[model samples]
Target: MEGICFLPTFLVIWSSSTFIVSYLIALFEHDVDVIFPYISEIGAKPPESCIFGLMTIITAFAGMATIYARYKFVEKLNEKAGVPPALNQAAFWIGMLSCLGICFVATFQETTIIQMHDAGAILFFVSGVLYTTLQSIISYKAYPYGCSLALCHTRTGMATIAFLAVSPTIICVLLHRTEDKDYVFHLVSAVSEWIVAFSFIFFFTYIHDFKRFTLKLRTEFVS
Candidate 1:
């Protein structure tokens, strides 16, 4: 009980501090490269640096809040019977091992075995996604666990596809005209698109579930 009481306080402070720092980094780091001629550029430099700085800080805080909330939710689930520590530990170890294996395989491959390295990377990601999905099914199906499972699946797919899609485009762009920054920006855009897509999917799913739940409650009351 006492432990639960401090969770919220820790979350508030952790998220707030991270948000401020992230916002400042984003604001001060902006350059002409960030601007898109067709669309408006956000956080463009202005005379009132403090205003943007504050906004940046708040945005950073909000990002940190998401992570903080996730941690708190997982902790609460552990307190409940949602997932045992052993299962959680196993899933973590498996994921870590998969990452290490992929890194090792990639390191050994020279230019002649680039294809092999790529294959290993793909296999690694696929196994990770399947492993996470299975683990989620084995664990109790509740708020944080279920949500984390969905997020993992979504993020895994995004990462795999984003790398595949962006890598070729970046390589091609670099081949034609060399600009490291341009390639990086394009890669970032591809990843941002995935995040936006997932956000919309999550938003609609939540709304649909809420409506269905409301309907069920109304039916029960009427009966």
Candidate 2:
């Protein structure tokens, strides 16, 4: 896990930057309404399409790597302290499912396969929330497991993240309340999507333990 922060940090910055740029491009190239246009609308056209596709590949790999690194790190620490696996294999497999959803969403544009795209989006969000929450819990309990104080210092932030992560569910209620106002529902949905994204990014920041790992070249032969 040495230098493990690099890829996750890159993935966050890359995904955020590309999505923002692509969303801007989509606004100019498509008939996208500013407030209500879903983030997926960005992938409906232009340089946006290419950006989304690239973002997807980068994110998929990075997300999987992040999961693996965190799980293995936690597993090792837990083993050392004689604590059973905190999140365990279930969390890892669930994370992989989330990765699949992310890849699916990126590879197929919502404009092309609306149902499939929506399904993927749903899976990604739900699984991501679950995964992050589980990791947060595991980290909270991982005292003396060599998790840095900074990494485990998510007390106040964890509450904020929990509140933010409920954005989509709250939007669901709002969506039903504003049944007749399509624009309002759409606008709310867009906001909720961004909320989820930001919350997830912040949650990953809590996994600062990877800073302890470092990479080095091994000159050993691959016999």
Candidate 3:
């Protein structure tokens, strides 16, 4: 159980470190603006791009593990509470799709494949927001079993903020595209992207619940 808790904790730490390290390298190389550069921009060029792509790939795997563990955890609780599994199942699939988006973003560099990179970003944000929203509802539904009211509220708030932030991010990105070097729109989009991304990561703070559950595997051989 304790070991399972580390999954989400590691996801948070590794993802944040990936962004920070890539950002610093890009900054020192004068590859990005000092203020509010798009998260993808820092990873668009040479050495930093390599690190970003590799680390983000690992982060995507970590995210998948954390999300799957969470899905199982909620499923168990819902089963015990005699609640239907539809919502939990939906959330699990949506979360997996969001992680797939992360892989897409990591593989497609913005400079080399701008269309793919943008598509990946949009997929990640939209799926992530939906995932969190569904999980928040699941948390409330599972409250009587193991989830706390406070945790439910926290998840709800973070999901709402991520949802709100994504709208401005998309709007500003589109607006920036129409203009010539509009730093203001770019800055707004960058800031909003950070907020949404971190909010998605932070929602994994529910890792505390993982302490009550264990993940195990069994192998069987068939003749």
Candidate 4:
């Protein structure tokens, strides 16, 4: 019951907060003229880059929400199963470091590259990988928590669904009007989306089984 209650709350907060923050950053940080390179087009002088950025940002935040909610619920479950707070804290910190490493690499690339949008997609893909890896760590660490298994599974499920659902939509929309189907740019985008989609799947399955294994333990104990 607690898991159910906390999961939705964490999801709502994390999703809303991250999306708002990322949207504002995209609006100011990205310049549309670079990608579109047109002077007289729809909504002249408006930030077209922000639209795509918003889409990506929203997608990312949704995933984060799922991860956060799952982590918290799992933490509670671990507590019930005699897991120590120190262990959870250690695992969480390690996950944070992993996530930071990916973000830092992406930041370095963004700074060095001039035409960063395409490369940025690679970074986003990396980010998704790190995100999943961290969630997997959390799920694995909380194995003693019985009810937490469900939340852990939910987290992976949501992340996988979100990425697979969002990436193709984003790619198809961006590439739809583009005539350069054979261009290297299109190829890179396709590859990046594929990487992101599969990473999410890997993380989902990994975390789901981790949770289920823990739940199985709990069930045995109760029986």
Candidate 5:
């Protein structure tokens, strides 16, 4: 929605709160010691299933908010320095595609459409990696200009993204062994998923400075 850009902080709160609550709901549904069970089993149940679906939908809106803010943030940076327009636009639209992927995954549950869900999941994570990597580069460059993020922020953000980006490979490598060995793969995948999830959280920490970005808009003369 056009209004999504108007309330960036609201989007952050909505997305963060919804995800935290939904995860809590799912976490309580099963055992706590193992990550595999949490990754694979928790969301398929009654209340958690509903919560998961709602969280997915909220995430879509949150993604929209992210796109709205991210490019605008870069647009301002571009004015201070030279940032590739293509890179900024690419980051925004690709991020949007990730949001669409989240919606697709939510609509088609793994039980009903595993292939589609997996595709969506892949889209979300892959696009997220590209979007973050591109913006991180831009931010690092813009640091000399006026970007408020500290060096540590950039370093941590990149590290978290790396942790997340490496996870799919782990899943692919370890997912197909025999039952005895498969749990190891599942555990790795589960850990990677958590890394990715937290990476997202870590990335959004940049929101603290978004208020410095002046919202750009166009209006027609009403004469």
Candidate 6:
């Protein structure tokens, strides 16, 4: 049961390490620019791309597990507090969609399937920010019941940063593409993308409530 508490931590480590290792491999191989390359660019080619795709596929499954655990944790908290389940349910589905987006991004290489890769990136960032914001709201609403005010504030702050980063990410990427591949816009876009991605990752760190819960499997027979 207590071991479940580490799931979120594992997810964070695995996801962050995947990107970092891929980035280093791409850097050493001279596949991407030295300064603020888009995360996808680092994994756009072979070798690193293979590693990135495989690791990210695993990360996506871990993300789904983590998000589903959080959803159930919140569901229990809401049940205890007599809070409506609407927000929690919404957050769960959106979080799942973000994980699906990750699969798309991982499978469709940016250079090979640029359109699908870009679409996946858009879905991931947009839905991820929304999911975190909704979870933050749920945290505040469930305050004093398996959640602390400080945790609520922290989630809200992270969500705000992620949400703020999203607009600049999209706008700067578009600007970089349209403005003759302007380096400034590209840098800003890359920075914002990293911020948004990590913000979403770190938000799951507030899984202290998971310590008290355990997942169990039972066999059933149907007639």
Measured over all alpha carbons after superposition, the RMSD of each candidate to the real structure, in angstroms, is 14.5, 3.7, 1.3, 11.4, 4.1, 1.3
lDDT of each model, Cα atoms only? 0.38, 0.69, 0.87, 0.43, 0.64, 0.87
Task: Write down the worst ten-residue block by lDDT for model 6.
Answer: 200-209
In model 4, pairs of residues that clash are none
All candidates in order of lDDT, best leading: 3, 6, 2, 5, 4, 1
Question: Model 3, 128-159: lDDT tens per residue?
Answer: 99999998888777777867788888889999
In TM-score terms, candidate 5 sits at: 0.79
* Candidate 2 residue-wise lDDT, 100-142, digit = tens: 9888888888778977877788788777777776665666667
TM accuracy, model 1: 0.32
Please write out the lDDT profile of model 1 over residues 1-223, one tens digit for every residue: 2322333344344434433333354445653233321001222233223343454344334333332333334445565446655555555555444444344333433233545544544444444444344344433345453444565455444444534443443344344244554655555543443332222121122221222111112334554
In model 3, what lDDT does residue 53 have?
97
Q: How accurate is candidate 1 locally (lDDT)?
A: 0.38
TM-score on alpha carbons, each prediction: 0.32, 0.81, 0.96, 0.38, 0.79, 0.96
What does candidate 5's lDDT look like per residue over 3-104, in tens digits?
Answer: 233355555566567556656776776523434443324445567667778877887886787676767777877777787888878878988987887787
In model 2, which regions exceed 4 Å deviation?
Answer: 146-181, 203-207, 214-223
- Estimate candidate 6's alpha-carbon lDDT, on a 0 to 1 scale: 0.87
Task: Write down the worst ten-residue block by lDDT for model 5.
Answer: 31-40
